[model samples]
Target chain A: MKWSELFTSSVGKKWIMGLTGIFLVLFLIVHVGLNACIFAMDGGVMFNKAAHFMGSNAVPRILEIGLFAGILLHIVQGWSLELSNRAARKKGYAIPMGNKGSKWYSRSMGLLGTLLFLFLVMHIAHFWVPSRITGLDPVLIDGKEFHNLYGEMLQLFQGNLLVVILYVLGCFALAWHLLHGFQSAFRTLGLTNNRYLILVEGAGALFSILVPLVFALMPISMYMGWIK
Target chain B: MQHYNMNLTLKVWRQKNAADKGHFETYPVKNISSEMSFLEMIDVLNEQLIKEGKEPIAFDHDCREGICGMCSMYINGRPHGPWQHNTTCQLHMRAYQDGDTIVVEPWRANAFPVVKDLMVDRSAFDRIIQAGGYISVNTGNAVDANATPIEKDKADDAFAAAACIGCGACVAACKNSSAMLFVGAKVSHLALLPQGSPERKSRAVNMVAQMDKEGFGACTNTGACEAVCPKGISIENIARLNREYMMAGLTEDK
Candidate 1:
């Protein structure tokens, strides 16, 4: 097989999707951990500092380009898979098999991923764009100035119930997406042993639930005035 | 053991030939014995059709005991009927109740086109196997089975993968109609064995190339194939195949 087949062949495309999906998940881990700082409730002191460090740093600044590229590749590859898979079966069954053969989310990854993409757009517009490009209002802590992405979270979540609800809904979509995707990325990478798979699945389930739960809690806490 | 008869409403797919646009024809079957296999019920329906001077429904079946993997029917939206770990030939009529309406169709993937009625041309599988499903060995007297000194765990895993009967259920069951499970099973079965070591890399590379050439969709790891597999082949083999493909495809010296 030619080297170009890596992006063309079925297995090759999947390999790329798996590699990139896992890379994105690793980004999620960092994002979730940093976002958890909001729960500190110290007027976004630790949270703002960390967010400022990540945005200003040379390494992460460069890595952000790769992150965007990875996301685009994942979405493009996902679209092709969805289209070809739809074409594979030219006709529908007289009766549908709903969640009989696999989990609804597992088969519906295409839908779930689409929802996540929309959510990501809103999320990026809400935070990533202002923090990185347009520049957010600066707050001073310990005589140092930091772009207040955390303050934006606090104000937005408290002000708009609809946005908060959408954010929560987006988190729900993320949970379902991760539920299948976390371990699925590994499976696509060919980690088949039951011993190791048990660990991967456990971690995946925990990550799927905890990351979204904590992320959702941030908006809910701010909206409900739980956080200062 | 109790036996009973039930009448059923059968909606069967009928296609005259490869070029023909097919449609479903409903036939009401009477006195279907609960004890009879699903294929036997179809046989009864075919007999009735012959008596009525109508064309019989065409289906593929051989070695009715189920090992041949010849039976291919999407009964009531499942690859085989509702029975778990069962072939269409092994699916007994008892799975359905009286007055049930069962819709049967041929395997609906581009690669496995309808030959006629419920039978499909599965020679695409043969082509994939021909690409690299086998390992080369010199023909001679049989060596002792234990001469290879295979690990018990690896041997068990290989044997489990070998249980795949080359049936198209995996392809039929997958929403993507991916042949990954089928190819994975073949790849895993051979890749796990000592004899399979020689062609392991090329086998993964070539079989996947042929599978793609045949126009099958990619696997999404939904495990639909694993769920509907009559032999209960696991998707773990698919993971193994992915690993094999990645390693073989990337590191090839040529």
Candidate 2:
């Protein structure tokens, strides 16, 4: 089938949106859980070892590649869907206010997702690629020396207050993106019941908020000099 | 209630016939009351237009109670103005200012061609509904409502789906101009009920096929239709429709 035909199909787009969305949701949990390990440890050798483990592991390498693919697919599919919608309507009309009934986040997904994409680029350029490629020493944990990825990350976070602020702002954007996205994904995938919708939307909000809040805090703490 | 004297300009669309080129003609309506519905204000204006021996601006309206779904227009760029759940007929003159220039036009869509002035042929929706809304009921004296002991959940879902007034607002508000929500509502009503069960498989299959047959775009779950629907029909109904279609597709394979 032609590319346009696939993107414009109801069944096809739903699967694309759902499959990519579910993958990103899983990625969020794993990414946050690994970062949360930083909070559990005293900010020195122990955290460094954990970070080194996550950064250097074979499985983590595969997961990172998969996560990148997921983000790309999600973005492309979402943009295509948005474009078709715009093309369908010939004229514009006022969206009723307040009780117009859609959540504000629902209306602004495309905007927030665009901002998040920029943030993602900055995130990778600052941390993911440079740390993986450049040579770095490991902080020795209990006489064992490994790549000191955690210490490098801390140094990067502390050295730039702007990075800290941007990371927090990015987290806020992600939170808003996921607030509507999570339940909307369920609706797209055909998993809606009123009882389940209320539950899913509620749980989705908590999960979305919690992931970004926890991940963004690591940079925040380092910038504040809370951990040295 | 005191009737307040005021003058306001209306940019009304005028067309002599379907092939006739249309243009906006302004008219000044004076002495409007807050108690009058928006359409009543239009009536007052049309009454004056007729008195002057000019062609009266034509528009659609019925069941001023907001249920008939005949009153579809984009009032000041809104599908149904700024108020939620309001049809143009239900919108009160109090919602506007004395000096406001209210621009009115027919609901614009390829499927909905303008008939004349503000009235457009919404027969596209009727064609979609007729495509699959009928179920074979043996020639009938009315059956007892209690004959079918439908689960409360299913009954509620069916009632919600039945609430769709065949309003073209969903198509009007949709960015893709998708009729999925409208078709989904019909499919959902049947899929959720015992009376509809006998034809459940064919109903979804046929309704969706007809929805596509009409020049409607596909659903992308942008939720614009749900947001603007006066009835507040959730897009969840569309999701349910998807599930039913999937199951029907699988069942037909056997």
TM-score per candidate for chain A alone: 0.96, 0.88
* Worst 10 contiguous positions by lDDT, candidate 1 chain A: A91-100
Q: What tens digits encode model 1's per-residue C-alpha lDDT throughout A131-199?
A: 878989989999988898888998888878999999999999999999999999999989757879999
Candidate 2 residue lDDT tens string, B176-210 = 67888888888888878878887887777667666
TM-score of each: 0.97, 0.84
- The CA lDDT at A151 in model 1 is 83
**Candidate 1 local lDDT, B27-123, one digit each (tens):** 9999999999999999999999999999999999999997999999998888988988999999998888899999999988999998999889999
Model number with the top TM-score: 1
Candidate 1: Cα lDDT at A111: 93
Q: Please report the TM-score between candidate 2 and the true structure.
A: 0.84
Q: What DockQ does each prediction reach against the true complex? A: 0.75, 0.24
Off by over 4 Å in 2: A1-8, A55-59, A94-99, A131-135, B1-7, B13-25, B62-65, B82-84, B94-101, B108-115, B136-147, B209-228, B249-254
Deviating ranges (above 4 Å) for candidate 1:
B138-146
